[model samples]
Target chain A: MANGSGEVVRNRQVIFRDYVSGSPEETDMEVRESALELRVPEGSNGVLVRNLYLSCDPYMRIRMRKLDVPSYRESFQPGSPIIGYGVARVLESGHPNFKKGDLIWGITGWEEYSLITEPETCFKIEHIDVPLSYYTGLLGMPGMTAYVGFFKVCSPKKGETVFISAASGAVGQLVGQFAKLVGCYVVGSAGSKEKVDLLKNKFGFDDAFNYKEELDLDATLKRYFPEGIDIYFENVGGKMLDAVLLNMKLRGRIAACGMISQYNLEQPEGICNLMNLILKQVRMEGFVVSDYYHLYLKFLETVLPQIKEGKIVYVEDIAKGLENGPAALVGLFSGHNVGKQVIMVSRE
Target chain B: MANGSGEVVRNRQVIFRDYVSGSPEETDMEVRESALELRVPEGSNGVLVRNLYLSCDPYMRIRMRKLDVPSYRESFQPGSPIIGYGVARVLESGHPNFKKGDLIWGITGWEEYSLITEPETCFKIEHIDVPLSYYTGLLGMPGMTAYVGFFKVCSPKKGETVFISAASGAVGQLVGQFAKLVGCYVVGSAGSKEKVDLLKNKFGFDDAFNYKEELDLDATLKRYFPEGIDIYFENVGGKMLDAVLLNMKLRGRIAACGMISQYNLEQPEGICNLMNLILKQVRMEGFVVSDYYHLYLKFLETVLPQIKEGKIVYVEDIAKGLENGPAALVGLFSGHNVGKQVIMVSRE
Candidate 1:
């Protein structure tokens, strides 16, 4: 590739077909190739980046739906490249925040090269000793989300009880680890036996259960937390939340992250045990990590050292090429990936 | 009646028949005569008090239901006196906190005399200037509940928008006034037109509506709070809470005081828009005033002046005697009483 107006590359992208219902299938997306220039637009505060790693998250499923009111995220445009968090290298820059050859991570197009007009949204990657893909999981949006949601929103204290749903996924795994670090009694629920074993043996969750296998969520929660739950990191909504309400201790906290189970449903399941909120004096709050993005530098300072010292661990399930992007993105809902789902697009 | 060891008074009492499934009817209770000794029980720390006023509250309805697990308030036992907040005068004392002729307000039996074992629960009434009946409504449990739930739990700020449900009742009316005093734009909803009028015209609420007349609660809330609600003092739950959830602004606070609407339902209404909490970064918390009982002294100091200076006002709907107690207690469920429903058991 040459660094001039004449130089162009075939930028392939996974395009969202249309709005979907139930679970998204791989065929709902189509791979298409478009032309891309190697340089950022002239006289604009934009950075042209070569995309490396793409993050697969449950929240993207919400972005695929049409909303009646203004939401925190916009619906994905039909026949356009799906947008998500990615690690990239700056090929050209018209922005003061970044220089050519600098590595950065932020929201980007699911293509080989992207002209990021919102240059300020991306953060410059300082530490390189760890895998660059770490930005997609441990140091990126999902990691920051788990950190802020647990510590800031939930206000967890040492020796408190913590519960996580979708426990082996990107955010849940880190939350479990973070709760363990804070000396809390952590329990998590996942869909498969492998994920459950991973939570207990690998992630150090005090107890783990397969939600699919459990016939009674309330009884299962009672079995795991005999005293009652103090902090519930809500990832799966519907019946799981209903059970959690009954099992929450007095003055418990619920950090609503994502409701993977109900996002695709035409109408969300009704939460029946809400009156328990009044009985137990519980607080159910929801938060988006973008609100606490200012804490990213501080988060990196704490997490990078832990990662370097082997005090913290992050696992990634990587897909090796751009064509497999659709399957990876759609697979989040089905729990196909073991850990943080990342698609490796290019090499450094 | 003589002042001797065997001397007794005819104690006319209202006794709960059994656990009720629906709204408690007048027939659900039976009035019968029991013997009350003029003196406190010997060899026990009990104070004999002559009952004066009994409070009829929404929480009492919960006590009439059989539960799967033990709740804060136990189910009313068959053939036992209905337990509630009451104003009484100490006839005899085996406890140091009270002596003979001391007027107090606390949990007492619905009969002529009560042997109060836990004297610490009673607060000695110092001033007789205010109506003694106020201890059952404005000066007692409901008043403290409103103060703590609004100021402490809601953490309201001036210029914020506030919405209260069941707005003409004991706690709601006071909360509306408190919001007004704090420079908040307050709107309230009640079941009857008279109650709505009482809220806006008498209680100083900025706006009021009859929820019974409003077909679409969500649309009504939007009309009342065009900019969205910043603080919601939840009293009547079910549909009202569900509507309030949709109208809550970013960083909104919901203080769950009581849920009069859902108390009689076999299965409580499901709250579907809880996901809004995460999208708007809202905090919905449930609390019981007993947790903040330590603030009682401070509450009286703050409220007494307001009442004396005519900065705040309270209304009471009193039934003349213990014979009318069953009707007053049952009337609470039917929205029959105009204000705080109190049974005037005896004159001060």
Candidate 2:
């Protein structure tokens, strides 16, 4: 698989077709072959890397729309290769921090290779004791998202009741385990029974419920959290949010990590019970993980040990090739993926 | 005019007729005469007071319904005398904190005379330098609500942009003044052109708008706050809240004081733009002023001087007697009152 230095190579890329309005489909993106030089362009401080594992995240769905307002990320260009977080092996570098053959993880392309102009945003993969694929889910952005959301944002105290929506997803799974580590009671809601089982049996949630089967979400929440929720890690929004508002305890905190449920709709479902926020004296805060990247090293220190000791676990649903990337990403909207959805682009 | 140490008197009362749905009407309550004893019951720690000024607040509308969940205030009991905040003169007291001839402000009946069993909750009026009617608006519950909500909940900084809804109402008026005092640029929205004029010209708000005239609230907010709102004192909810969510600046804070717009509706309006809270990394919190009563003395220390120096002013829409109490309270739902609506039950 080794190519001569500076040799021209064929790169397979997933290209976004156009701006999306409703639920994104596999046809919205296409896998195509493009030519690339296996070198950083002369006089440019860019790092050329061959992407390995690409992360299929819900937030990417937001970037598919033509955002009329300010957002943390720009909308994906219609004809360009889709940009996302991925594990990559640096092929050539003109940057000070990165070198050829160095393994890294950060914002890369959904293609086999990418020319990253801002390589400084990339983290050098220092601890490969865990599988490199973990960098795309457990040990990378999602893990850091869980750490910041649960510990910094929600500030859960011992014995507090915690609830996570999309519980078997990458970030929610980690949040549940972190709550357990803090000695808080944790319950989770997912779209399927298998995911529910994984939350309770594998991730150590105190209880789990299949939200798709529940006719009344407020009643379902009451059944799971009889004492009321002290912390809610919001991933799926809309009706789930409205229902959770009714069941929040006094001074409860909701960390708005993502709203996967509403991203694909032309009109996001209306949340009707925000009055409960005032009645219960609650705080709901929204945050971006990039704001807390300065604490990434600190996060790894706290989480890495737990993973090694088997105190924390991550479940990933891996698609075996770059060709399957679009389906894996689109599956998120339909709750078709059982866990953390990842595209395995290459072995090295 | 003085009765002997103890005597029976005719007490005119505003009685809640039944649980109300939709817009509360004057017919929901009735003016009636009932007998009252001027003395506290034997060995009872109660204070019998002559109600003078009864505060008519928007939150009272919520109490007209049958509340099935927990709330800061109890539902108005059907067939019972309506309860509310008022300025009163103590006629008798078995409680050590109060005595006969003392002036107090707290929860009292919508009647000429009330026997307050929970006299401890009442604040004894210390300085009569200002008008006694001020206690019902500027120096009592609504005043404390504005203080805690602005200084404590919003944590507004100098030069920040503040926007308040229901701006000429009891609490919003004070919040706007407090924000201006903090060196912040403040804009307010009210229902009537007269109220809007009071906000800008009378209350010294930087700008004000008549919300009723603005068909597109979001566009109106954008016009008023071109730089985006940093702190929003949320007094009216529903469409206004949804619009504010879209116009909030980065890391903005929204203090949910009350939602007068949704109180009388059978189904509260759905908020569709809460996703902006995430996109902007915003914090929206709901609070009840009762939680901050420990800081009342501190609040008075800060506000009383402003009143004395003519740095702050108050406006009241005083209804003549207990007979007008129902209409005064009902007026809040229709935006009929100009400022703080207070019913003068008795001059003495």
Candidate 3:
């Protein structure tokens, strides 16, 4: 149905209900209709964006909680549209830089059409040759996270041994490729055999292992990293983190990206091998990609050409329509999504 | 009781019995009186040194345990004389570098006299105008530890805020002084009120607190470092380390020297604030003083002049004779010492 003021017709979105505890159920979100216009009013200093792809990241799980606990970003409040990074096209803009038909990627709402007032953080997609969907993943937050965490945080040198956890995921896959580009011996661990194969065959990681099959993580790490790990990009925390700590070499560097394992847990497991940090003289650092936004142009310069030349490859797990968005997002916890989990909300 | 022959008396050291669990008792060491000798064997490539002052450190407690825990240095074998850094006068030497009556410091036994075979690790104390006993404390391992851990490891910059734990101990006192020398706003935590005063009065620490008296360590750190901590020299781990982690500023650095609280306990406390590292982009590193041992001569050059001018001060809790050595050594865990704990086996 059309709006009373003669605006284009649109469906109102249902925001996720209050913060979820334990594993989030599909029932957490409720679809509610709203009497709102999708188009920006005349002289309004707002950009009306139609989100094409919404990124489902592990960091979002932290935001769903009530309190700010062990997270870089602020927690999401109840009865609000959960905010995340998304790839959107400007349908109408009252701002100068952004115009109709311009593709932009940055912070947007989880709904179909978002009225963005603070357009300072948004960036126009100058290079449109690549798939527009890549903006949701490989060319966006996940890509930057991999770049900064691996190169800037770890300071990896040539011939250094690198280990990446969740190596077939959006961020982990890019980290593995970056390490390989820098001439590092890279090894990765994934939850399934298919992801393990993807790490080795698709991303070009030196070695890959299915953590599901490996009963002893310590022994598995010892087998892969015989000389010990020089750089560890920690994505999945808990037991994997504990195992990686034991495998770190002298003066090793750890870039703490995300702790996917402990996100759903009531009480995270204790890591005992932390004393090894002192013995090995290791350096452990944790960082957020948002903090390194200033380096976006520099990162683009390094990563863009590689993508154009087919030197860098990316994979995505896309779900069609807003109807399937909830299922696609919830699939992440179970390692159901193969790569970057993206929801295609609309083409318009 | 002098031998008819012109010979030097030597005592074969009492060895600390194989690793003991829990608190070590005097029964752990067996002193064999029959090991005493009155002569230096002819044509031996070894120095007969009369032991003087022996330095006992908390790290020795870890070495005393036979378990194969990861340590920068190897553990002391059971039925072996527990070796520690000590100052002694060489009565006779077959090595050309060390001559008779030359004062030196290196790994030595907890006995009256010992035959030093490997003299390469030992350094001759040429400038012995001051008390030679100082070599076992201020001029020895503990001094190098404070110097390197603060200057080299943490890389403190002027006008930066620095926080140190165990501020009045062997290494912490010197670290505080060094931070003060580098123009850093230095704050320190000690086990007692007296040591806290010593940090402010003697060591020139900018602020001091008795951790035992402070109800909330996080509040104490916040009070001291209103601008937040730029550098944290971690000596005591567990709750103190966790609190420091929370109060760290953006891009802050933490140098982990020791975790005395966790060493004795069977179960170390879990750290829950690691997410702060991610938010602040903080770097936490662990290092051993031995890793930077090559800077010894350079360290002596910088620290000696400071000592001579009384710009750098050192204090020691000395126990006369080997009889009270056990109690003095054990005093570290209980915070019984004011500064460096040194056991005097004999007078020069």
Candidate 4:
């Protein structure tokens, strides 16, 4: 036993194993226990923080493979901590802007405590009215993503026909609500009946369907959008995108946020009805939410008021403990979670 | 022989054989000759005019099929004359604006003469400074197609990387020049070396390639646009479009004017790399140039100055007589003509 000398630390860290191919296994990551001195180095500009909650996003799957082109984010190095956006509390601060016990949200390591440098992108949480754990989900990157991707990129107009694929996911839920708020006829596709009900009842969508039960997506879209779809927020590609192409209206707009279906395939399926885009005079656009970060202040001004007025409802699937993080992340591929997936590292 | 007063009409018209499949043969069209009155019936507000020059466009191939959704223009009737944009004189006019001896350009019959009503879309031609047949190619629907497709649809910027497929065709030639006129770095792909040279030397493209020589279209586009394409004026779709999708820059725009490569295809080839659009943030829009005819005065405002100052150059391969019209019209698919193919039917 050792007496506390104003430095309390236990270095139990989640370390990545060798790079994975196919489906990821729990054995691919290891949690090792070791000793740590959780004191900030003298004259260091960085902050030492204790990670409270970790976000598990589908894009993290792309980071596992080496890419020829520089993708949205760099691939994770083997045998290193897999970093992502998370909520944390500052244990020790060497920077003037932040102090010990200050709550913040930013890029953090997959461990009990992390030394974070680039504090410019970080935000100190002032309005802690809601659950602090929300920083890992609805109030964080996913919310910003849904906002920017729909409003800015899609350029939605009132009374337009809007369709969203993977409607029960984190980004899709917000997009559907945003579309409804804009006075659009919103229809969404989900994997199960529960998710479909969540979209129609909770999200206030005009119509929702389970794609797993539908034999033909094209016929289903025709039933919903009799005139034709004016906007499509594409989260799942492959056959869904091909079907959407055929149903798009004249001067239609598509915001391609993600392609979850095509990510793990060795050879993705070919899209056949793209020629319909030409025939119908449609506009299809793709974008990343991080690129529009400068619009965050304006977005917050718009979203925060709605949140406070109880206009925008959000849900999260929180997996307790660091040990469950790996499984929670992998579950995203199978559409296991109902909403945003977050792993709670600690209650504080 | 027929005089100006004599009612002499011999209608020999090409008829569309019952909904063709596979590569369309000249045999698929049958010329049937019948006796007809040349004059519009009494009390009818219709103009009877002799057909001069008929225009052949790739979009005609799409009208040959029976689509689930009706196209912008109706499909040709089985035993009727193949209706197309043509140059003709008002031999007899029942409309107030048009009269006998006036030269006009609009949709007309493919045979010797036609009696047409609802001439609202037609316009009387003035200022015959150049060859009258030029109205059939350089100054008529094709010109409007090139102008509106490039400027309005593409939204070209100076020094931007622009690529055009089928660069030597009627519309593509002017699209290349329009891009060059806007100070863009223009590259074009053609079927043969002669057409490629014409695109570079005559139309003033920055680079021109014979696509027949380049086995890999993707590599060819990469070689031309190492930084990625800013705008792609898609004329021939299929493999060319698939390759261009992979080489598009962030926020890149594609104006889908035509898809000649897939016109005759029974089951058109599918594209696999469209998922790249999400990563690159691209915009692909399809348009019909006719929809933007309200901008004709604006188009003339820009084009007239270019022609007057010799800033624009036009090329045409003229067939000497009306008898050569059949051969000249069929020459499009074989890449037989150098530039805009025109036929001289008569002289005023």
Candidate 5:
């Protein structure tokens, strides 16, 4: 029962093969074409949107594994299209909030088109002056994650020392910039020398290091932060976390944003230094960005100006098409992407 | 340094033999008799106190080891008298805040007599209506630890579910009682059936389990808290912490008061389920009671009344004489003590 204007169209989608055990491979996802009606079903409050860009985040790996316990985000169905944060343009809507052509970003399918049953989860893009792809990272979910984790969770004080793991990534890069803006001494750790250079020169971090080159992370951290770190924006966990735990100052705050290093393992690495949390009186708090969406408008009000004025800079690694989505997503586990990894689904 | 009233006395002391590596033994400490001048030296701020009841706490295990990093407490000096929290009667005082005949509880040597140079660290016993031995457990540091950790750190709401590890210990018992006072459903885990019984019957905990009897802690936790735990009073770390992480509800709080299980280990157990913190959006905060000592008066105001009215109860495992102090202290690591382990130095 489709309208003449709402014809069935071929949708290119990335489907999750099965529940992953260890490190995810490109084979875990299959790019397949499926037919989808270009309209929300009658009497349903769903919004049909044309997905433009999809994010490749560390947290996605957690979703790939079979979860025994309840989690914030649901596991992606094996046969269904991979779901993630993406920038999309509304094609049709049965909801009162929209009619057509509204730019939005939130939880969407890693496909050409998505029928978002929960339209309320998608946020309408207000500032189109910025790149549309920014909604997949810098101006969207990851951006809010950085803002909430650093500002609210870490509660950074000016002149405090901050260390960030996976500092070249989407959330970490933004946290580094935010820390700098607040007059904090920021140090970042990345896998590659290029990312380290970007952290120091482009992201305005006080210091940066290639974690791969460092033999002892604890010693390296001691060298970077002689007095000990005040805030640790944790993205990479395992050894980095253990090392950071050793180097944290008294009353230190660790915002547990993501633990990428432990996500792909059969068994997560043992965190031996958590006892330091007591000795240092540290508060390690974990947060999901969805919980802070109430502060979204406030976040936008604060960050939009900084982005426009060049006070904050965001680097992105954009893959050209949905067919390349599997490789791009898999590459994230290997630290293959230089910055915010995004799959460019469609230009229009 | 001779005084008309002051006289030399034979002081029986427990001396720390050396820096310990793994599980501390009674041999790690030596009982020796030393001569002490029962007076505060002329023009000095030190207060000479006759030690009465010495506290045998798990944190003493951490101090037993040689620490490479800066910690809240310094390492126990080898070949010196073992230092810990104890009740004492001041026989001589040069400090303005303290005077002769004043009863105090704080950092004191595990000996018959101790000359405390830092008198400010000690709290003068205002309400001696309670047992003097209570100062080492129910009315002193461990009590304050339970108060700050449960009320301030956990931020528990009424009708919430709470789970405490090492529930029969000094801090855990009080925390359980406090949780019950706050109108929360409380569950606790101890090593023995007797301690578990004490938690349920004496402490008014809603449920209790012997962790040693439970093969799968996660399953046991699921059984106890069908709805996930809201607050976790973390007294024991390692496998318990990993298990607790899995059972925590959304936005759950874990007050990392102490980690008795991990303290004596050469290498602390690797925590595998810390990722659950992010997934559940939980907060695991480590706090030392010293940070909240400003509220000691307020804590006394709250807890003293409860103790008097029989709303709260304290269970203590008293080891008689300074000679038995080492066994009492070392027993903590093995879960041998049924409750708050204390050493009675002298009745006076």
Candidate 6:
């Protein structure tokens, strides 16, 4: 396949090598060259996208494994281009939902060009006043997840104490902002001092803590949430979740969005204090953003104005080029990057 | 002061010797005598009552231990009269909700006589056609818990598969019946063959299993619930919960009522398959009946008619006297009781 001008160009893709058990490494995926198909196939209902920004989310880690348990989404097939959320510009289309030059964000390959057969899956970028990279972080899947998890699942009440784990990341940062928007007292936990500072200073969290530095998570939770946690937006599960369970107030709600810490582990840790749920009459709910995608338009309406007003902010960590996609994704587990991590594939 | 006739009697009381750890023993409590002044005090809106039926619930075990974590309810005070739910005949009343000879059920001392300052806490028994002991099991706290936990928390729909742990116990029995009432296919797990037989033959469960006899609980659950459990009425929450978590269907709901197994353990068992929640989009919620007391009337309305029509039945394992209350309550831990464990103190 070649460009419309009949000149050959290379498409570099990050391909999954094999299923992994523990922490995934950059070497687990290989950067390979593929035929550049610059145009949508003739008589084919597909949109040819030049991928711009690829999202490096924690959920991707789970996809890299040979999922023995049932999951909302499928694992990445071995020896295939690792699929993830990305921002792209349509170069050609045979689908009615999209056409040439339409900017969109949805599931795409970790590569330069993707022939998206189902263009309807991608949302059209009507509001582009913000940075185009924002589509991969604040305006896309992560944004909607934070929206539904905090507002829909947790069901925030004004003046409630909201605690978000992994609080400096893409979804957590948005949840913290949303909690504050609803007049909640918000606290966050991040892994490093840099991420901790980002949570408190940049995101305006009521309190922030570096979980790694805190020797006693339970005591740390007590310090930040003296009264008790009304809502806990769970990201990193395992011990953090166990500690949070101990701190939850009567009738508290847990929005279990991700269990990143346990995802790569051979065994997910025992969450003791679960009896606290019955004692406090708490509600712990796990949700997937895909289940609530119909509310995307509503979420955009709620978040866009706040983003425009500067009341809500999003910070992104950018990795240049598709060659670095594996490292960018692997970085999420180590907390190497602050805020949302996205790999830059192409300017267009 | 006496029961309207002005006679004083000795009140035999079960007092907590000290805060216990792990499974509570009969020696942890002392059956002693107290002054039985069965009369409402002057200037007090309290009700004086002669206890009749004392309930021996699994939750009583949690109350015996000194809770290191903050709990919704307080632990039993050392050297104080052990409190429990009971049916009583009011000897005197300074509260408008009660009067002499009024039969009521709620929190009471594990003694022959008790002065209840909060008269409003007791529910006045209007229907007495059922065995009076039934008030301690079917018509009282356990009944309400089963009703709220199964119906309110689980939100059952017809044809859903329901599983209950501790199936022959107070709450589990009612949950199974409630599932059947809702047109759900119900399965339950109990410890003994007797209880298992009761669950299937007597209580109309679609199937029942003796969990103690099963080598692999997960396999047993799969055998019972071939499709998958849509609702799990969680009563025993250690290894059983871990197994149930694996067998839950997509969008399944777990109503966490009690964790009798974990309550005694220094460490609650590691619930390994919690990732299944994200995988199946299951919702696990814990509840206390006190929160849903407002629904008691609604529950009774739904249950009483069924009881009258012979569509529902209740079984009570009665401990004949208050002197045996300690053993009766302790028996719950060993799965000795084949049905709802109740201590019969007085018939009237």
Leading candidate by DockQ: 5
The residue ranges of model 4 lying beyond 4 angstroms of the native Cα positions read A1-8, A12-28, A32-45, A93-99, B1-8, B42-44, B319-331
Interface RMSD of 1: 1.1
Q: TM-score for all predictions?
A: 0.96, 0.97, 0.90, 0.92, 0.97, 0.97
Which of the two candidates, 1 or 4, achieves a greater TM-score against the reference? 1
Model 1 lDDT tens row, B1-348: 113474678888888899899778889898899877677666767788889999999999888888666556678888999989999998888887788899999999888778888889889998789989888888899999999999998998999999999888999999999999999999999889899889988999999999889999999999999889999999988888899989999889999888888888888888888888877788889898888878888988999999999988998999988889889988887789898999999885
Candidate 4, residue A264: lDDT: 77
lDDT of 4 by residue, A223-290 (tens): 99999899999999999999999899888888888888877776667887877877888878788877
TM-score of chain B of 6: 0.96
Lowest summed lDDT window (length 10), candidate 2 chain A? A1-10
Candidate 3 lDDT (Cα, whole model)?
Answer: 0.83
Badly placed stretches (over 4 Å) of model 3 are: A1-11, A14-16, A33-46, A67-71, A94-97, B1-8, B12-14, B33-48, B67-71, B92-97, B213-228
Q: After superposition, how far is residue B177 of candidate 3 from its true place, in Å?
A: 2.3
Per-candidate local distance difference test: 0.89, 0.92, 0.83, 0.82, 0.91, 0.88
Compared with the real two-chain complex, what DockQ does model 3 have?
A: 0.55
lDDT of 6 at A106: 93
- Any runs in candidate 6 off by more than 4 Å, and if so which? A1-8, B1-5, B68-70
- How good is model 2 by TM-score? 0.97
Where does model 5 exceed 4 Å of error?
Answer: A1-5, B1-5
> lDDT tens string, model 6, B147-246?
8888789999999999999998999998999898889999998998889899998899999888888999989988888889999999998899998888
Residue pairs with colliding backbones in model 5 are none
Please provide, for model 4 over B277-322, each residue's C-alpha lDDT reduced to its tens digit, 9 standing for 90 to 100: 8778787878887788788777777877787787777888877655
Writing each residue's lDDT as its tens digit, candidate 6 over A44-135 gives 78788889999999988888878765557788999989998899998877787887889999999888888887778889999988888888
Best by lDDT: 2
User: What TM-score does the predicted chain A of each candidate obtain versus native chain A?
Assistant: 0.98, 0.98, 0.95, 0.94, 0.98, 0.96
